[model samples]
Target: MKDEKLLAILRLQKSKAIGDILAKKLIVNVGDVEQIFKEKSAILQNINGIGNHGLKHLFDEKNLKAAEQELNYIKNNNIKYSYFLEDDYPINLQNCIDSPILMFKDGNINFKNDKIISIVGTRNMSSYGRDFCTKIIEDLVQYNPIIVSGFAYGVDICAHKVAIKNNLQTIAVLAHGFEQIYPKVHKKYINQVNENGGFLTEFWSEEQPLRENFLKRNRIVAGISKATIIIESAEKGGSLVTADIANSYNRDVFAVPGRTTDIYSKGCNNLIKNNRATLLTSSEDIVKMLNWDIKESPKKAIQKQLFVDLNENEQKIYDLLSEKGQQLLDVISLECNIPIYQLSSILLQMEMKGITKPLPGKLFELM
Candidate 1:
């Protein structure tokens, strides 16, 4: 919690081309980060790759001032930075060779959970891709797993939003720092996540969202999860990079299969064909792979009995909606063989009791 120690770590991380290697070196040899400044020349020379150019900047007054400014910004904004040695740091990521030495975070972080899963995929997703991601997320939320994603445009955004909608904790590991979200449009949702879950980043506040950072960020996403699920991806996509990293880390990688003709499905199909990833049809696939228990027999039976207690008419409506997902009032009346006027009142009562939810275009679905 020492401000000076935190500031020194931030300055080292901010330096380009000097990453965790130098950070670890400073921690091990210098006794403390402040000592790095005093013995700057000798320390730089001892490191293999670091040259005089890098060493010169380390002692520059301007660089120290910049680090102070960055530290001041974090303190003023109430941002939290967790170093690798900190208790709150994610243990899953601590062992990785290139793991981030520091992480800037905002909101609750639950590293103790065994159910953390990373849902990643292509930015360009089809409607099927959207539905698949949303359904699996909703199902997984029931178990209260921590959802992790990049918070990008297509699949990433869908997974985060659905987790939030279900009141589940969702974390976004950003390519940039917490000073600014990458896609400003997602700023609102990112704030919502901060209020509920949190955002994590390796870069300091002043670091821009560079392309290489994302590739580095992907490893953390993969390494921290029990499994990595790819909803959809092209043959060459960021999700595939994550899947490869997950495999290398000896974690399970699951891919949802898409049609062979689909450009997005090609990646998934290829993964399954080559045995690079297991084919995931539903949340059960992931749960089973992780050896999570399905609800016990007694609890499942109780739920079944509760489900059976619905009145005949309610059961009929539930069955119709469950099969078709959503239907307009007219469609429901026809499908359930009920009079339109009577069905209207019944649907209203069901909606009021949370038996179903209304959607746009005058559609309703079983809850």
Candidate 2:
């Protein structure tokens, strides 16, 4: 089918409530989306919440044309759309009551992966919040899970960066469209994600990042994952929205507790206190909650022999890298006070021994 025609239909379908109603309507109608375009005003008026006023908004020629422009833009930019009927569409999202009608996808995704976790939190995060996020994400990578999050600032970005650094697939669910990225500072990072992973959204490329869209987006983030983790949030932040939605969907919700007096942590603590979320002190808690089997430790003799073979500098680096999965070369050098040239050779030697691997930006991690 011509891409424009397909998108036009999707753009029209976007106006409908995105659940069984729309799914049934599309199934019963079973034709080009443009044909139903004419019936939208009358049809929407009959649906609850979409009164004559809202119906009129649907029929606006300017809006329809703008939506067409968006479709064209998406096609131009090489973005692809996946509808609920598509085989590759996310099954978890499809199971939701208010799943998106169409999603704009920009990278590789194995939607069928058994392990998926949504990490969400406030856009404004504390230092402790960042550290907590880093530690948990590093641990989660061991299971090769897909990490989901909104591409917002603070905790969201931290999770994404960590996922990428650890060679995990991360999906950013945007509140806006593929046409533009909100919080443009993330544009560079988003590009990097697209190159390595991807971004997803229900809105068309031209759709604005309206305040209400974010609330709707939160549902997707919550719905698509097996569990949702809130690292930090203000009492009224949007992370709570994702947690509530996760609860409604019967997905596990985890919150990390912090000092009661800390503003950013109040939301997490409250959720835990109310029994709305499980209190997670470490990644081990989440792994256990999910019933994932932890890998057994290597035999003591094997570990001892492996340690004995390492030279003094190599042993020091190995110890540091084992404690944390990844560390920048500069950080390692500074901590060990080793010359860069010597450190490079040691890192290469360790890599040859299958003890570590290089990551983006000169970082290295234990294998």
Candidate 3:
């Protein structure tokens, strides 16, 4: 990014009222981020949610100074960043509705390989959690999947260490800024993590790891991967929050079932029981559930699975699209005798199953 564009984004990010979600909307609404600054308040206020209150914060002079200071720190430290619109941004995280607009990274971080999955659990992991986590990462080494986790203690550090030992890429998504690392003792593992993969954060250079930041940070952990696996979690904990966010994004979620008596196992147990997560036993489960067994071609694999997995209703809908070609959502609903209300959810399910894909203008087609 140019100096002007970077500064504008920093300033917008520092603004109080405008968050990541609204910042994206403003940029899209105004045609560009820099244009947001050049456009008059009258023009900006015309945007759906932009009002006098929002405009005041959008152009706040105090935030400009803060942004400039932060930008200076970034330049002085030779920090690297990826804008949401840029090609270098993490592809999975890009699909999230509320992903950070800008992310700072360090170390030899390569996102070219798409086999990224997050392993997250409670800070107070037990012996069962430790053994399962280690064995699973070792088992998954051959698949060359990138392991993602928070750099906290217990399960987080265990995942990072095992991934490094297995010679696999492991990304640590931090809750605090680059200047600080929580649990201070975990600092020793930082070099190992960078050597294997690296650190990624949405926070600025000097931000603290406040309580609320961890909750906010959970979203990135959940959204940055193809799936999130919970080795162990208490009934109420951060890992559970990550699982919830993953489900909301319609991503795959896996929880290791354990003895119901274990306190740390409560969350994972409930997750499996409530149908919020699939039961996970070994590395094979992950590979099978995620369809990592690559065969001939993606299209051919999906086609072959259709006959084996599609139900009567799904088959009718799939057959119509296969025969008639791409059609509108309403048209498919009418032709297949499925109501519009029911068709929407069916389409979403088909999308998750890799059977059909949705296109612009409410169009649908076989994958």
RMSD of each: 20.8, 18.9, 8.6
lDDT of 2: 0.77
Candidate 2's displacement at residue 351, Å, is 56
Clash pairs, model 1 backbone: none
Candidate 1, lDDT over the whole model: 0.79
Which lDDT value does model 3 have at 261?
93
Query: CA shift at 128, candidate 3, in angstroms?
Result: 0.7
Every candidate's lDDT: 0.79, 0.77, 0.86
Candidate 3 has what TM-score? Answer: 0.83
lDDT of 2 by residue, 229-249 (tens): 999998988999999999887
Error (Å) of candidate 3 at residue 105 is 0.4
In candidate 3, stretches whose alpha carbon ends up further than 4 angstroms from where it belongs are: 296-367
lDDT of 1 by residue, 54-154 (tens): 77666667777888998898889988888875557675565454578788888887777768899999999899999998899887776789999999999
TM-score for all models, in order of appearance: 0.75, 0.71, 0.83
